[model samples]
Target: MLDARGLVIVFGLALGASACGGDDSSSGGGTGGASGSGGAVGGSGGGATGGTSGAGGGTGGASGSGGAGGGSGTGGSAGSGGAPCFDAKRLWFEDFETGDYSRWTSKTYDKNWNNGFCHDNGFSTAQANSPTHSHRSEITCADTQSHRGYGGLQFAGDSVVPAYTNQGSGIDAPNGVVNTYWSWLEAPYAFQNGKWFSFWTVNNDCGWKDNVITLGLEDTSNKLTPAHIKNTGGTVTFAPNAPGFPMGKWVRTTIYINYHEGVMVTWQDGTKVFEATFSRPDNDICQWHWGAYASGDNDDVVLYEDDNSIWKLGQKWTNFDVEPYFGVTQAVCSP
Candidate 1:
């Protein structure tokens, strides 16, 4: 069944969408639907009571408790025994299930320079991490310009998700607040033979109008390596210690930006890829955006994105074991 996080545990049943279908972290893991009000994955009949302080775990073993039924459940806890508890709220999430870009604040394409190649952006059903639809962007050729043919979405500031400041202590500080983005990406064979495809970037629209942090795929000498752009406009490319970016399949990616501390971390399929300190200190994370951009050389490059989410990690420094609020089963616990 689909829990409050809108995640479906495909044991043998169907799924349900969230009330704020366009922009909420409704994807989570569990069997029985949540019980009290907001609904968390409970054990037997229902799970914990929905409020600031959870009432009781469900009847069974896999129950957890959190405010407004927002906690993820494990094999034990809440009413049963030792399940973990977490509280999180969604800043933005676009599963592309609506089959359009209606959820985004704005859309951008190839920066007024039409290369005459096939720079396209839309929805696709070919492959999706969620189930039905996903955002697809394809580029056909290389660009000599710095900002090449790119098609993407812009997530500006809104009421539910306001701007955050990066002026706290260093990494892992107690006053740290993290803003994380989770998404599934796939590129069949575009990242081959020294081609670079920019999947997402956090740009500063307020002061310097520069990219504070950027992540992309760089095929250096035919070896797949993740690339990042520093706030000072310098490029740092390194191969992952673990398995590199795989071709022809979807991979889970997580980008964590600490607003309290000027630190950024990246993970691919639960493995740490890289970590860096933001050069631009005391910056505001209000106008940052993400997209798919093709640079260097390109030949029939295609990228697919599904089940994208932005979350506010209040006390959690990293996204590890926070909750299964994105349709995937995560280790249940308190952070």
Candidate 2:
């Protein structure tokens, strides 16, 4: 998002286009040598009386040229150019149900389900340590309840219950508001693991606030088992341009992580959003839990969720491509 200062710069550039000046004309030729300048001023030569230039017929005053067309006004710069398009392969979660866990290894830790406050039936809840919020509760899974059946990973308000009273602390809240969301795959996870991914959203007293989708990978390591972990954070805030984002409605969020040397680029809704490079190797030991962690009350929570599919890492785009075909045309008969 652009800050106030950037807006000022943009406005200044826009004003520069009007700086061109208008035109001015030089005085026309003096009324020719006043007919008496020469010796025989016979009748001032009628038409030539103004001067030897024959009065130049007043030159019709040069028709006042039409303002040079204002140089076409520069067209206002085309509105930031549309986002580039890229080919995407859809990876569904249902594929994992048939024992295709070869590409993905679910972090096999048990989540001690919470029986309090009526847990949403859709989420696989758990408790875990959050880097930013310290320890918090979280939820994970897709929202199958929606007609589109897209996946989503979420964190609940109760997870950060302790920090609720610690509001206004810059260390935890940048906007001075209490927020609960997803924990991204940090350093240790990215260095050792090959792929890390998640889908999440932010909710508060205002209802469904916005969405932030992420995906990353980690390498193998001595300190951890999985080797590496990485992910991306792409946020879609509440604004007019962001369509299909419903307040209190389930929006489908997805992420695909592409790992490159030192850099990982993540795509949300088929568009690239986050890119970062790592200085040290990041790897983890297990396939992390989705809902809640085994030991803490701070777990990731999700609502309006479903888990009908699973996809593996390292699968090529071709694995999910569906080719289009045209059948033979039928002939029509007329009376």
Q: Provide C-alpha RMSD values for all models, in order.
A: 15.6, 36.6
| Worst 10 contiguous positions by lDDT, candidate 1 | 45-54
Q: Give Cα distance to truth, residue 220, candidate 2, Å.
A: 36
Backbone clashes in model 1 = 12
lDDT of residue 134 for candidate 1: 54
Candidate 2 C-alpha lDDT tens digits along 1-335: 01111100000000000000000111011111111110010110000000000000011111111011100000111112322222111121211111111122111111222222222221112211211111112233322111010111111221211111212111111111111112212111222221211122111111111111112111221111111122112222122222221222222223222222233232222223333333222221101112111111112322222121111222133211111000001011110
Q: Tell me the lDDT of model 1 at 136.
A: 55
The C-alpha stretches of model 1 lying farther than 4 A from their native spots are 1-83, 108-116, 146-194, 221-240, 318-335
Give the alpha carbon lDDT tens digit for every residue of 1-335 in model 1: 11111111101110111110000112111222111111111111100000000111221111112211122222123321333444433444455565433444332222222433434555566655555655555554544422232222222332211212221222222323232232333444644333455444443333223332445554432222223233233333333564466655676666556544555555566565555554444434433334444443454555565555444443464443232232233222332
Measured on C-alpha atoms, candidate 2 has an lDDT of 0.16
Using lDDT as the measure, the top candidate is 1
Report the Cα lDDT for residue 161, model 2: 16
